[model samples]
Target: MSNNNNFRLPYFLLLLILLSSSDFLPSVFAKSQNPITDSEIKKKKSECYADIDSGLWGGHCKSSSIAKENCALKCLSPACYELIYESDPLEEGEKDYIRGQEYKYCMYKLSVGESLEGVRGSFDY
Candidate 1:
């Protein structure tokens, strides 16, 4: 019995130590904060949903690909929204209209021909 306890004690201590250290923990069940407000979360979720980079780009939106990528990140903080809005091509009325209808739709449109093509050309870095 004493020998058994000695073996069990070592195993117990090891488990305690391993659990106390975060490195050995599983990441899948971890909690993460979005750093954005309830409003932004609601706004963005209403905007679009993208399969987070699952190691494959899958297929781009084929229409507003850039806009899809951009709005896909719309889950980011409010600061990110401000940064992105500055760059979207919708005029004031159109932007408002699109935002009202479905910001995701606007995001979809952004991944398109002349709009994306022009950006690709005009903003060549």
Candidate 2:
């Protein structure tokens, strides 16, 4: 009887260790199964922009500011919002300069009857 009791103690300790280690095993497997590649993210972003361009949100695609603002709101991820809005950390003066440049560019595009998407591609930010 004593021998059986001693054997069960080691088994219990072993079972506890296995159970505690089980939590880490799923994450290891999950990493391989749940791969979110960059291309997938880009595809989501393109789909988001397409939705915005279709005027589904009651804003015309010709209006750059409105389109950009709408796109930011509808973006799937924070990175997508950054791409559509391009509002990286900037000094106040730099922000003003970039805003002015964007306004001029949008006005020019509008004057020529170009779509906001065209201007979006022309700018780096």
Candidate 3:
């Protein structure tokens, strides 16, 4: 009985340590706040577009409205969206619109090969 009690003591101590140290534990599930910059979005969008265009994402996505949506979904993946929006709860429609706009503007910027700092501000496309 004494040996059994001794064996349980270490397990109890370990459990206590784990629970008490929760505050100091690194948050593996914590969402990081590193927002994706325009340039990074541009790069990712370009890559996804290229993949779709080249039939890498799928042949069907190459010549349909789905192509645009595929690129938007690919570039603005769940992780990317979380990084960009970071806890901002948005309606599904708003989220879709934002994703589409981001993809559109990034593609335009890529094609133009220049900063759209003032261009985007001048008019809503």
Q: Give the 10-residue window scoring lowest on summed lDDT in candidate 1.
A: 112-121
Q: Clashes in model 2: which pairs?
A: none
Question: What lDDT is reached at residue 30 by model 1?
Answer: 48
In model 1, the Cα lDDT at residue 65 comes to 46
Residue 92: error of model 1 in Å? Answer: 13
For candidate 3, lDDT tens digit of each residue in 1-125?
99999999999998888766865454444333354567866677677777777777666556566545544554555443333333443333344555446445544554445454543223344
Predicted candidate 1, C-alpha RMSD: 15.5
lDDT (Cα) of model 3 = 0.54
Which runs in model 2 stand beyond 4 Å of their true positions?
1-35, 60-62, 69-74, 78-125
How do all models score by TM-score? Answer: 0.24, 0.33, 0.40
Quote the lDDT for 45 in model 1.
58
Q: Pick the candidate with the highest TM-score.
A: 3
